[model samples]
Target: MKICCILCDRYFTPDKMQIKKLRKHPHRIILCPECHERIAERVRKRKKLQSLKRHPEG
Candidate 1:
């Protein structure tokens, strides 16, 4: 079976991954943990940039 990447919306075979569930809806979907971590890291980075923009000294 191929697992879907929630971030890129691509399908990769199970043989090529470390699968994980989408935190918001864990039961209905699956993704490779690396992809999930990348997505989360991107979000975190974006949020940090936004916060920095809001508070220039911080």
Candidate 2:
């Protein structure tokens, strides 16, 4: 099945499991692998920055 990424608006073919999830939850946001990785990395970096801001070391 061809699924469109909500962020990039690119069409991609997801695996059976992903398709199942989309079918089960139609309201879920779909993202391509690249966009997903990029977003995840950004989240990780943001979390790290927040931790450093909370606890600074000499």
Candidate 3:
């Protein structure tokens, strides 16, 4: 089955393992690797900024 990435809307065919997982958990959605990495990077940057704002010692 071809699944579209929820973040980027990129359509792609998932691997066999992912297909099985999706079937087992239909509520779960698939995220493309690029979008996943981008999201993770953004979250990390945001967390770092927040931490700096919370503790502006140095």
Estimate, for each residue in 1-58, the C-alpha lDDT of model 1 and write its tens digit.
5667776788876542233333345576566667877889999999999999999992
lDDT of 1 at 4: 78
- The regions of model 3 sitting more than 4 angstroms off are 13-20
Q: Roughly what TM-score does model 3 have, to 2 decimal places?
A: 0.69
- For 1-58, candidate 3 gives per-residue lDDT tens digits of 7899998899988888889999999999889878878999999999999999999995
lDDT of 2 by residue, 1-58 (tens): 8999988899999988889999999899889999999999999999999999999998
Worst 10 residues of 3 by lDDT: 29-38
Listed per model in order, the count of residue pairs whose N, CA or C atoms clash below 3 Å is 0, 0, 0
Query: Model 2 clash pairs?
Result: none
Error of 3 at 2 (Å): 3.6
Cα displacement (angstroms), candidate 1, residue 34, comes to: 0.7
Query: Between the candidate structures 1 and 3, which one is better when assessed by lDDT?
Result: 3
Report each candidate's C-alpha RMSD, comma-separated, in the order given. 5.3, 1.1, 2.2
The 10-residue segment of model 2 with minimum total lDDT is: 14-23
